[model samples]
Target: MGRDTSSAMVEHLDFFQSFDDVKVYYDNGQNIVKQALDRSVGKVLSKVVVRRRKTSMAGYRLEQVADYLSTIELALVKYEAKEDGETYNKFFGGIGSFKRNWLKQARCKRI
Candidate 1:
């Protein structure tokens, strides 16, 4: 991650601040992440704890949930862009249903 993405993460510092402690788990590239965070949010670094995990071998339940949510969000973006219509339509039952159903429910759980 570069300063740009790290800068984006800094924008969410308030979310991190809400929790007493924040733990970030990554599958790889710990060094890059650390560097990014160091440059972007170094002052609040003490509140965050970063860990490296081989998710493929031993993944946490939250990680699975995160993956699911991200996949759905990506699908929504692709649908809006009018890309991969067939697959999204088959799974989500068309754009109207996808928005009224999936996206609505997902947004309710947004943090």
Candidate 2:
């Protein structure tokens, strides 16, 4: 809240009264976060459904084996691409841009 959510807060009663814009923004941010969480949950559920289809019976076991192999292959490709400068830069850049902008200033520096 603009009401100085800070330590010396009560003094900012005027700031609380002026919170109309910030209240709207807080609601909007909560909505966005809820939507993202919903989407992620849907994705995780879908993956579980797909993986469950490869159970241990009949040809299912074979399918599971193939799926595991493909997953490992894809992981290898991603790992190798990370070692290739241009590919790694592009991939990481895309991800960095997609994450919250607030995170930019929060990045940890390594010595």
Candidate 3:
């Protein structure tokens, strides 16, 4: 049996509570968080494929794929912004206490 990678991933990110910490950890060259997420999504996709082969779950797979795509896109945005010299909050507007209280831009910027 394959390992339930969703739990593995959730366990991996046990420290970070916001995108700021996530970006910090990621910028510090520790990518296991996002890597875990990717691995989990891959596992879920494989499970979806197996399920689809056995029966019809097209709608569930479609939703799962959409969610995974959005998650990947968000991670890319944060990674690119961090690489481009922007703080996590400045780039993605994390819901940390400091950022939420202070950095709420009147107009949201496009990623």
Which segments of model 3 are wrong by more than 4 Å?
1-29, 47-101, 104-111
Question: In model 1, where is the ten-residue run with the lowest total lDDT?
Answer: 46-55
Encode model 2's per-residue lDDT on 33-80: one tens digit a residue: 645444443343332332212222453554555554554445445545
- Index of the highest-TM-score prediction: 1
1 against 2, candidate with superior TM-score = 1
Please say which candidate is ahead in lDDT: 2 or 3.
3
* Cα lDDT, all candidates: 0.71, 0.39, 0.43
Where does candidate 2 have its weakest 10-residue lDDT segment? 20-29
Ranking by TM-score: 1, 2, 3
Error of 2 at 10 (Å): 63
- Score every model by TM-score: 0.47, 0.24, 0.23
Q: In candidate 1, residue 69 scores what lDDT? A: 93
How does candidate 1 fare on TM-score?
0.47
Instruction: Estimate candidate 3's alpha-carbon lDDT, on a 0 to 1 scale.
Output: 0.43
**lDDT (10s digit) by residue, model 1, range 1-111:** 666855676688788678765655444557777666555554445524543334462547778678779978998899878894787888998888998998899889998
User: Stretches of candidate 1 above 4 Å error?
Assistant: 1-59
Colliding residue pairs in candidate 3: none
